[model samples]
Target: MLKKLINIVVFVPLGVLLIILSVANRQTVTLALNPFEPSDSLLSVSAPFFVFLFLAVILGLVLGAAATWFTQAKYRRRARSEASEAVKWHREAEKQRSQAEKLATQASLPAPQG
Candidate 1:
């Protein structure tokens, strides 16, 4: 519920602002040059103004995902190493505690001090 409220609060004004901007600048034209040549002659997507916006959004999403995955890879590796080291330490501690208990029992069995 709170998340939905926050989303509405954040995106509602953003949507309104975009609508206002689109209305105000509805007559403007922007052009982008495609670096790669199309192989098919009939499938040339060269001229529409909205195509640039679409390509920009797609590129942004791909770059964002790549950046997120790249940044998190190191942290994931570190977390795995830390978890394994913690398990190893726990086992070593348990072994040492058991040995200490055995030594204590043996010492209390009335052995003569030399």
Candidate 2:
């Protein structure tokens, strides 16, 4: 219930704000890829203002996610190894318990009175 309210409060206004911004800045602009030339550029793109703005935002998100994944890789590896080790120990414990129970049953049997 709280999550839905928070989403509505935050996302609705954010969406409306973005729509207003895009509408206000609909003018086309030229983006020059070549750094050396300013007046005349061979590599360039002509797109709406919102296109570049959204592209930068998307790029930032992608780069940040990549960095986070790489940074936490060691932790993920350690957790996987720990999980496998725990499983091995658990199997060994069950085997020992079964062996003890079998020994107890054998000791309870009567010996030959020759």
Candidate 3:
């Protein structure tokens, strides 16, 4: 239910905005690749303004996500180790519990006479 609401509120608006941008920015513009010579037409490419806008946005998002992942690498490693430690402790506890139950049952039974 929340997902639907989010789609309606966030995604729908964003999609409409992108569509409008694309339509409004349909004009072709030259993009220079080299920094040394900005006027070099041979090293430039022509594309729609919307294409550059979307590409820059996507590139920024990818770089930002990659930086975030790298920054949190230590946290991710710590969480993974903690998870394994928790599992080990849980198994050890279960084993001890079973052993205790077995001993309890044995103590409850009557001894056999020779």
Candidate 4:
């Protein structure tokens, strides 16, 4: 619940701002680009407004993934190292316990009196 509220608070204003800017700059912003040059044939392929928006979204996703990978790489290495150390310690503990049990058995055996 808290997460949803925070997202709304953060993104709602940003979305509204984008809408406002889009409306204000509609004339200045080119919604489509002609694939053919001015000297080329009359046939021209043009992209729509949504195409630009889609490209922007894809670019943001790529950048976000790159940033996350870079930041978490070190932590992933550290976690693996800690897990290996834990396994080493656990094996040593088991060895020590087995040795202690063997010693206890030896001590309990009847001894020849002098």
Candidate 5:
């Protein structure tokens, strides 16, 4: 469908770009976690530059998803309450409908002649 076409159009180019970047940035780099001791190997990780690039992208996506989920919690709660309210109303309507039908049948029945 259109979604697949859009994915192909968008992701194909992005994939190619990522591949190019990985190829161009094959040089190894070290990420130092110890701010006080920048040269401390114990708190550092070394990998290809593209590894860090991809990790950052993945981390950003995870954080963004979490933020979006947290922000939309109120809407989700409201939807749940609305759904329960609808169910309650529907049950009340059905009860009323059955009562009306019972009265209609009773009224339709012939009275015994005295």
Candidate 6:
């Protein structure tokens, strides 16, 4: 419930602002890919300015997420190693417990008659 409220508070205004910006900047702009020929229509893309703005924002988010994932790789490796170690220790403990129970049962039995 608290997460929903936070999302509503943060995203509602951001969505409204982006909508207003797109509405206000309805002009078509040309982006030229070839630096040698500035007027080449074959190497250019023409679209609304807001489209480019939104594309840049999306690209930045993707790059930031990728960087964070790469930086935390060491911690993920350590966690996997620790989990395997814990499993090994637990198996060893169970084996020892069963052996101890078997010895206790043997000691409780009566001696054989001569």
lDDT top scorer: 5
Scored by CA lDDT, what does every candidate get?
A: 0.77, 0.93, 0.97, 0.78, 0.99, 0.97
TM-score of each candidate?
Answer: 0.52, 0.84, 0.82, 0.54, 0.92, 0.88
Per-residue lDDT of model 5, residues 8-113, tens digit only: 9999999999999999999999999999999999999999999999999999999999999999999999999999999999999999999999999999999979
Candidate 6 structure quality by residue, lDDT tens digits, 1-114: 999999999999999999999998789999999999979999999999999999999999999999999999999999999999999999999999999999999999998889
Candidate 5 least-lDDT 10 residues: 104-113
RMSD of every candidate to native, in Å, equals 5.8, 2.2, 2.1, 5.3, 1.4, 1.5
Q: Give the clashing pairs for model 4.
A: none
Q: How does model 4 score by TM-score?
A: 0.54
Q: Report the C-alpha lDDT of model 4 over 6-100, residue by residue, as the tens digit.
A: 99999999889778755654443343244555434345434545556657988999999999999999999999999999999999999999999
The C-alpha stretches of model 2 lying farther than 4 A from their native spots are 39-42, 108-114
- Model 6 error, position 57 (Å): 0.6
Candidate 4, after superposition: displacement of residue 50 in Å?
2.5
Error of 6 at 96 (Å): 1.6
TM-score of 2: 0.84
Can you rank all candidates by lDDT, best first? 5, 6, 3, 2, 4, 1
Model 4, runs deviating above 4 Å: 8-45, 111-114
Looking at candidate 3, what is the lDDT of residue 33? 90
Off by over 4 Å in 3: 39-42
Residue 32's lDDT within candidate 5 is 100
Question: Would you give me the overall lDDT of model 4?
Answer: 0.78
- Looking at candidate 3, the ten consecutive residues that score lowest on lDDT are 4-13
lDDT of 2 at 1: 100
- Clash list (residue pairs), candidate 6: none
